[model samples]
Target: MTANACAPTYSLPATSAPLPAPKQDPVRTLIDELLAEQQRLQTPVARFSEAHDRGASPALEPLYRDLIPLSKPGPGEQYAFEVDLDSCTGCKACVAGCHSLNGLDDEETWRDVGMLVGGTRNHPFQQTVTSACHHCADPGCLNGCPVLAYEKDPVTGIVRHLDDQCIGCQYCILKCPYDVPKYNDRLGIVRKCDMCHSRLAVGEAPACVQACPTQAIKIVTVTTHLNGQPALDTTAFLPGAPAPEYTQPTTRYTSSKPLPAEIIAADAATLRPQHPHWPLVFMLTLMPMAVGCFTVAACADLLAPRYPLLANLPASAPTTLALTGWLAGAAGLFASVFHLGQPLRAWRVFLGLRKSWLSREAVIFGPWFGLATATAAVPLASQLGLFSGSADVPVGSVSSALASAYSLLAAHYSLLTLATASVGLLGLFCSSMIYIDTQRHLWRAAQTIPRFFGSGAVLGFAILFAAAPTLPYFFALLGSVLFKLAIEARELRPLDSDDDTPTASFKTAQMLTGPLRLPHNLRVTSALLACILAFALTRISAPSLLAWTIPALLLASELTERYLYFRAVVAPKMPGVVSK
Candidate 1:
């Protein structure tokens, strides 16, 4: 067929004609039309819309209306949280409502639901706990804030944060046992649930209370009890919640069913050390070093006149010490500014001096820095002859008059030196008290005071010996390190006393001997090597290299030690969930 004329001619196939439409049955058409008509006739149903949903419905109106009076009571009454444990279904609707209604960050939640589990294997049990801010009668966050950012409503007893006043120090976070105040890093302030005060003022229920389908949460008026009547019973708190006696939280947990004695928070077993505060670490370490150097140098200068051996000390020694101390002090002060969220407003730090240790620290350090500068300036001024009498002296001036200028300058130098030394010591005392006032058991004055002073003394001697080699200073360096090591050795063992929190104490001990083992060993090794170098090299013919190396080593070692102190100490806090 392919030969010559039989070859096939390719062409597109002719398009197929469209098939005729199938006819529909009359009864089927009638049924389709009926279904369409029925759908069209039915009323439009309301669908869920988070934007339009205010959680207001006919069924919720009566329940929430009854709660309105409790939230907006008369002068003698105060608002408080009321929860019905039996009605809670762990649906987390309240959490969603709070986050959505408050316009909060997606990850930030003002309310949380936790599960408490207990009972024997034969009778396993579980209960859901929904908790938010209690607006405590004596809110620890309020009392602990250095800037007075938190205040309790005199009329409603709702604890509210003054965002404008906060510096985001987060001390309130440490102080609050309920762990309610949440730090907002973006705003550099702490925020918490204020019991939806604005809504309560406008006669609306809180988001949580309104959103709960099971009517688990309510608002109530808790009359201010007279003569110290306890506001809460033993069962008012979920097991492992912080004791109410401490903060006097006003939230009420109600359940008709008996909670098992063994019931405990799911997070009770978790224990970890506090997060590292690097700014505080640097501030603390450098401050003592500066104070030590200045005080020792001032004392040495004062004694130079009385002691012949001291008079023989190098002329550059005191000058070098004063200058180094001034530099260290300035660096420390700068480091402290970084710890404040509003460092530009650091001028306000002195405002709370009457009641806040943090304020006192600023007050004391301010003058301490001023005096330290004056002490350093005196020598420079004398060398420049700015304060020294003119070489000519007045032609008619008497001999005493000529001596008067020199005497005045001398008195100014001595007085300035003594003041700087005194203020520096006082500043150290104030620094220690800042942590002590938090009532954290680990930061007691007894432990911190010695540590601060001992570190100052050790670092001072090490630096001095490095600058100017001396037998006595070398011995002093050895003694201080030995004593300091002995003191720190006590922390290596777990605390077993009743007054201490067993888990926290043991955790601190374990950190010291476990995760921190390598750093701790390195610090010890560096310190011992420095000591050995000092002892061995002090006798060598050319010891100039030892001058800088020994103190540098000692400084590094002390820095390591301070890091451990901050990292190992366990602060009391709410139960934290342990991650699997």
Candidate 2:
């Protein structure tokens, strides 16, 4: 009992004071405070909305404040790009911004940067140029579109492409002097810079303007008229760019220093082949051949009865030729359909008939096809006894009516042939006008008119001679072919000139003799071969074989020539870097 009492005598400790809290690390304490503060902050969307409601300026406002106009354009005025050459450093930030903000394809850019170089050895100079759609006072793309796929805004004067309305004919590409409109392969349509129209509508600068670090590009109001009339003074356009007289481009390039007199594009000497446009090549070649056939058939039908040499022609010859022409025309028209990126939208091609030669060509050819079909089929129908009847049948009877109708058609058949040929000739004129209107030096009226019509004449005479094997047809073929070859040979004259300037003609000459020399030589060789075969046909009797061979050779020559037409011609553009 005593031991137990002693063991129970141990004392319990009293409640101890709280131990001192471990000191917090300074970095951790600061981080915790920041995390709590961040939790209380508003989201970016809420902040932006609050700022907008309070009329606070955007973060980017200061960056693009001077790049855009303070007010909209007034009467006789329009918005245009004004570039300060002295301020530009050739940085491609504008291009990147345009592509990103516009959501353009990876390889596509509305803005382009180029270099201009000139001056003597002692005073060499270089300038960087940035360019995009000029939004001209008179736009060639709008004027040449066969479907009205482009429009200039009435108030702002921005040239905008209507993507949905475009058939992707790309005629506007050829029409535009500065090569502004670009084709989008994925969309099967053309797209261009509309000056970031939607952004401008919301009082924001264009992507290019906003992103240019040096503030080299700016939007400004410019006078689009003179003496109260819509006229443009294009002297303010860039010096090393395409001529502004054609489209009246409004982009103004300013510099403190005067440009060199001999300033030229960096890429002026580069030789590159253009798109072949195979469908157009086929359409052009075949349609002209069809026109020639119809024309020759008409002439033969009219003169055969009067001239003894032609009188020997078989009665089926005219009908055969007309049929051949109709077939060719049909094939050409079909091939043209393939040329359109949006073939289904081509129904609207006639909408631009007021300004577009392509539209006129389409409209005129539609009826020409119908007339040609009738011309080809009517005679065949008569030969098949569809219009045959005894003249002595009772008057007013169907048989008597048929006989009368047949006789009337027989009397006016030559006239019908003449009319069809005339319409086709007119369509061909429209075709030639399509290229001539482009204002390219290689596609001027003098070159295009003769080339198109001459091709028709040569091909036509070749076909007629093949059918009749007559001396007149042979001579006509020889003369027409020789004339066409002579016209093509004139393209080489610039090569012999002492002047070494890289003008369009000189560039064309260089292209023909350079990379395109193989095709050019083949064209000439085929033409000569056709001529030789034509002469041989007169000496030898091999109508079936020579007929096909001669026309085939002529066709090959014409196709090659048309290929060279597109390949050798130098397109005018802004100065660019030398192509690798």
Candidate 3:
């Protein structure tokens, strides 16, 4: 109903129509009384739930108590999700169902089914698990996103991804252990199971549940006093994530197998990090590495101002590279927007502060980068004599704009400078978290010093490599070497634990190319040693092979470590185990 479309605000002085008291029709009066009571009760519930979710609840807080409020399903309410694991038969009917139902593009799915194989090898049985957004309570996706595009229905507890509010960073993919978020390369956005909330609001089951063959999927409300709990049979395919804290996932899986303890154990350490996306790291750090590389090149040129050609190059170089760098960063960032379910309306991010850092970061990011980018071009303008830096201007006056410009530039660059340092560090943090947070001893080794230092060194050297022609980036390469050593040290350390996982991984890595470690390592080490000695004999002058060899050895080791890392992940044997 349209707002203000109802009766006037002022109450009429008690209706003087008592003479017409409708002849006191008892049945009609009783019906009117009953309808009024029902409407009164429902209207309060509806209002409170909506208001409470928006954090503006006075009446809602008490009426609903702790229940979450869900956005009402769209008009013509029709929706339900149903699943039967026993008869699922490991087929993927629902995936296609979701794709078609949601008008998802090719290579996109609104729902999917994963297979979990268990029951001791001899009596192995495969369970086909269908899945989509559980619309979780305490959704890892919701918590981990830097953008606040997710919403939960107070009544239904249906967590929703608001397409219009998303920027498509795909951070949700990492935050979710189920691997639900799919990267739509074409759209340059991260898409996931939207839970068919729209359809559900309109009284329909999610597309996947509707499409499941054998009646394997179903919608249910397994109610108890507690809220946000999934329906009794509902299960998610989360791998290495938190325990089901009754986040009230609406989608439930009916599995024949009992839940495992090991998976639950992994969840303790693997609850997704609050800052999983690390927007600050990207904005403040990574962007600068590229920018700083250009900056350093600019400085190097500035230092050699005596060289006419070099000085002229510096004048435009910063501007040109700054523009290019911004473009690349912007391109990547823009592509990220299409990943949102609703791209056109993304400004909702700035509305919340205390509850959302994503909004906070986004609110500041564009402007911060904008100011920083312009500040970067300032020295360039100075080069062109656009304005004299030393020109006398009144201090403390907005007229000069100096105070304001200084303050703004200073404020902007603080975060922007931080962006530079933390980019690689945050990426490392993510890499470490991926391994450290998971339970596999083999994978956890990634938390060791080697990975920590090595990744930084490798990335640093890569930057150096790109900027090699101008001047020395040796310090960067030196970092690369130290990191390489750390990698070696991590490998040499005894398997983090004697779990069969590490042993299996090592054995697998060894046998991957026929036989095992001895052959693989021996071949690699011998070739590398030969090359190193040959270069040593060549006196590091003519070939410049020294530069290549250092990274090569470091790279080879990194590749080997990566190979092991890949082998180390222990996938629960399901017919359709998730892997990227």
Candidate 4:
């Protein structure tokens, strides 16, 4: 079939001047008009921006007029949270608002609502207390941060965390009496309420302040000092909360009705064990062990010249002890890295040395480690003939000078050992101070100082006796272990007390005997086993076996003790609901 056959021809019947336009439907016309109107309308965000650009007040301004301060703080004053205890309903709306507005994690909340209960049976009283960062005049978190991650604004007095600067050491968590800083596992840093400083800067109420239905939360300017530094009046700070004298907390919790003197935290009786911090446990245990080893090595080296027994011992004993000390110190220091969320950023840990004990510990340990390494290396190098000259070489050759210098260094190695041990002792003191500064009852100077120094002495003597199998070292180890055990036993005395008020010390006793019973028992068993092993070393023909075994037992005991050190201590916190 051709194209012409398939196609049909058509002829025009009439000629037209123009074609008529199609008529528009009423519905279509109305829809087009509505679309045009919609295009001309401004979005809510755009309207908000326009309103601000026109110098108009925000819509919520009227509602939160009295919720926020109208001006910046004056001289000797800073911003603080002021919550009316009478108005708090424990609804946790402030917590929700804080979480949402700050885009916090699902489980993270900067604001918390806690309950305080007390009073006689007839007049039983209960109240919910809303709390956030008090923006203290002397902030413990700021003081204790190794990298200076926290800073208090000089003008506003809001303590702010520098997220990028944080190494996620979590020391601030221990430092804060109120437990304000919340660690963010995802970000590897801690965060807390800045009193919504960003919002307050722009004349807007904080999220919690705005979210309160009853307007119980408000921002106010308070005097930071009365006569001298840290003299802020903390009388109005929440009762049944952590003592405010330490940090000079500025948050005011006021009530129309007088609170009962017997008011106590709802969770007061709860026995919540804290994180064991395995890395810290090992670090604390092993570092002190290294220090002890160094101490024994130095003492042995110094006494060997005068004492026939020490001199008659193996010539390699001092070198062996120093090497062991170096190895332990290195391992302990390396273990500390695992505790950091950002290990690479730990170089900045020295930034807080002026204020933080942790910083001091880190700084002191670095030099001590270097000195220890050198002490260990020099003897090994001499033994390997690294500084020795060839037998055929002349007496005045460069190798001879090197050998002579090495000999001089070897002769004076004890001085280096003494110096290293001294620095290590200082480092251990800093370590003890790190916890002591937290002001926990269980970690007071009386308990912590002896525990730390005693562990060092016991482990040090145990290691020395292992190396040389001497009677003096054996007795020293036994005495130190016994003393340490005695001090630790003091912690358990409260367990047998007739009074059951659940005080901090009593609570610590409960933790040791209850959930932590196994570890506590193991600690004691290890120590006793070490003492038994030491005694057996005197009778056994295979003294070598007992020599190594005693130190192992002592190490196990100290590690368990360190674990319990962190776990049994009852950290101070705000009162909240009873735990299940």
Candidate 5:
């Protein structure tokens, strides 16, 4: 207390007054004033000249003058493009204008000009259609985004991509019908036409609109109901374009000249498969196969006691099953990282789980991986004598109790197996949904679900046959192989005549029979060989050689089958040059 009382008191210092900034030299001050006056006088004339250079003519200015107030739509209103197809020259001025004004990459374009041609030779008809982001009533890009990277303005209905928030997964590119969004590889993000929203906000038309020399492209106010007018119907679209009712695309195309009933895209006959996504192919194949392995082992163990055929088989050790599942699941997941433009930002994949099937796939697979790892680790821990068996000294009944618990856990291996099996199945389902959600004919659930699940079934049974040499397992493997082949064969059948659009069906068939024919033939050959080997392995005493060989053949066949699956898919895109 005495030492505390002896502490010195601090004194409060008086504050000084603030000093004013020094005055500029008279000569410099006079010069600055003169410069300001000169800039003010030059600004008005410069602005008018700038607008004139943007492709606005005297006749177009009145409409341009009136369009500014309506550019940014008010509440419950929406802005859309009205294209007068008759006046469009396919000059590509709009495309160039958008690219330059938006500062897009050299290889990237947000707008495109497509030619629709169809009519009698005597009355020939060809029309150029300029298309950009439709900003649809149901924006697929917005709905499919994993990270909520896309947003449609409630006020103006302008679809905008939030670049900083994007992980560059490219799911939106797949979802968009018009193919408006362009991925910037250097920036590791996606950018799209916002209809020059910044320009619109300042009472100016979009760059594309202003740049149209013939005034073919113009801004208009449309009711929220895209189907509000008959002009927006499917009949208005060019050939090979998706049905307007699907996304209710807001861009309206009109022409005074009557187009033929069978207008076709100039590039409709072009056969181009989506770029081979190697990481996706590996992840899709290996992860499901891993899940199948876990499920088969678990089911085999659970059913072994009940079924006579499953009895006395050489099932994989729990350690092997756990470890295989762990490795396969982890490897598939790691490989998927390379598929993203910004792999470092892959953690954002979970952000779109609510609406994006791609996100759901990530979320579900993550748990599957964790469970598999834990299952593998338990057996490893027991082997290392970390949980049970020979330790230095007994602590108490707790240690003895843990030792007994460990033994019980080791005995009840089916518990972890069942859990891993459950999660693996869920992961497979999520994977199927990733393609199913695209709504592409080739990737429909009827096609993708069966192929995906059947792959797991075939590979899982093959694995089970190897793990435990059993007749039922071999038979199951043989049956699944045949079933999968049947499904693929169905793809060869002529497309349904009753279906409204057969372009996709025709394109898919061409891909399968044309480019992928050799692979398809080899796949069937491999499957047949595997089946023959499986049958022969059952009869021979030393079946180890055949056991390993059959699975290898089966895996090769599966790889080929998956390659075709991706190779034959014709993703819907806006018509463009074949090289694009």
Candidate 6:
């Protein structure tokens, strides 16, 4: 304090210190603000611009509406997917039959047959499995569908697609190991056996079921099969059969003897052979990158304390950022490559602009992938070897400049990836918006995060967790599961909504706290008491009961929460019932 009194006033360092800055132009401010508004406006425009996103094209809706209700077995129309290993030759005749009748293209096979070889008789022991859709008791297809495009009749339980309403997300196909939903890139829609809806409406059998000359397939009600009837005893009802996990498909088939258990096992193994290839690869690629990506994100947060400053970050953070940003994206592209049957002709994938997220996903990621690569490599080169002894050393060297540019580019991709998630969320939002316009409180409410993030967190974790330490080499998966579980679990905790968001997921927490809470409470209390009695039991019980115990508690609580969300809210269709 005394120093001020002793010091003479130095002229305000007037080599002309920069003046205190004035407020910038409001026009500039508005323009800067418009950046995001510009983005929002561009999204709808981009959707319209895409050839495949048809996005309810007035032109296409009528065309789809014309094909609506699909020529299905109709609601409750019993349909069968039968295989005659004995009389049936692996001719793929039913496959071709389904195509011709359904107007499916060369790539789209409504039905296909596989060979299951078992029994001591070597070559002759092979049985042919010609299946379209098993229409299972639990159609994994129905449970996994995000758009709610699938509906099974309560009476007969025939699963059908609401063609006009379906967004063609391909999630149903992803859920079905059998790969029943066939995507038509030309139309950007999924084509599958609708149980010959039009024919079934008239009490006629579906094309494929009828086409089976050996009479291997027969359409029947769900009750007939689940009754522990003879139908369940046949080869048609073998373990791992095409039986869907949720829909309780009404279609039924008959067999002579449920082949020897070994043969049945072999046949079940043969039927659904499409092991998901991406999770393993993504785990390998993504896990390592998550470490890098997070480091990049975290470091950037530290260095750049502000928005523009983030753009000016050093190379190390960008390298990490770029690589991490690209991991999921590049992996997703790789996954899409394998998802298609003829990946060589993948260029044709882009041709359908009016109706494909797969296409949009492909389109968006292409540039994002390139930037991710260059950003990662250039920065890395400078960091390691590119600028060892230059005048500018590392920071001001030509290589460094290039590195900085790439680093910034990578950040943009990160933003774009967020945009992609937002786009997808919005697509789901559109699904909700569509339902809202209908005044359907059920769908309107169901439109919340549970459908996207909840289901995504659950299924993604399940898929991603398969690679957990005992699961896989990558923590990319486990970390995400933990992160998502932590965040989403919290989101599911509070029951907040008005029509505000429909059934609150937090209600699931309530269920766990109230009605369903007792079992877990007992388990927890008993476990605590048991620990006092014997700690060994806790370890033994945890893996066996508690592994599932925690997951089940969470899942049951969550699924019920989701179900309550679905059931409690009344849609306009079911008039006079108000949401509880």
Following a full C-alpha superposition, what root-mean-square deviation does model 3 have from the true structure?
15.9
Measured by lDDT, the strongest candidate is 4
lDDT of 1 by residue, 1-580 (tens): 4486787678977768976888966666777988878655411111122313667543334335655563355554578888898988888888888898898886688898877777999998787778899888778888777777788898888899887888877778777777787877677667889888888877667888877767788888876554555444434755667777767788888889888888766665555556677888888888999898888887777888998766786766676677778888999999888877776666666666677777788889988998888677656545545434553444335466535655565677766777788899999998888777655655667667888887788888887887767777789899988888877777655654444434555667777777788878887888888898888767876657657788788888888888887787766544344466
Candidate 1 Cα errors over 4 Å, as ranges? 1-63, 66-77, 115-126, 223-235, 257-264, 301-312, 380-409, 495-502
**Candidate 6 lDDT (Cα, whole model)?**
0.45
* Rank ordering of all candidates by lDDT, starting from the highest: 4, 2, 5, 1, 3, 6
TM-score of 3: 0.50
Q: Kindly report which residue pairs in candidate 1 clash with one another.
A: none
- Residue 571 accuracy (lDDT) in model 6: 20
Write the number of the candidate with greater lDDT, choosing between 3 and 5: 5
How many pairs collide in each candidate, listed in order? 0, 0, 45, 0, 1, 34
Report the CA-based lDDT of candidate 1 relative to the real structure: 0.75
TM-score-based ranking, best first? 4, 2, 5, 1, 3, 6
lDDT of 4 by residue, 171-220 (tens): 99999999899988888788899888888887777888867767789999
Tens digit per residue, CA lDDT, model 6, 134-203: 6655565565544455676655455677665445545466455455777767765565777676666654
Question: Candidate 4, which ten residues in sequence have the lowest lDDT sum?
Answer: 389-398
TM-score of 1: 0.79
Name the candidate, 1 or 2, with the larger TM-score value. Answer: 2
Candidate 3 local lDDT, 216-320, one digit each (tens)? 666655332234332333344343333444233444455555644433221121111121122323332233333444444444444555755444443444444
The 10-residue segment of model 2 with minimum total lDDT is 389-398
**In candidate 6, which residue ranges exceed 4 Å CA deviation?**
1-93, 121-124, 164-169, 224-236, 239-251, 264-580
For model 3, the run of ten residues with the poorest summed lDDT: 266-275
Using all chains and alpha carbons, the TM-scores for the candidates as numbered come to 0.79, 0.87, 0.50, 0.87, 0.82, 0.38
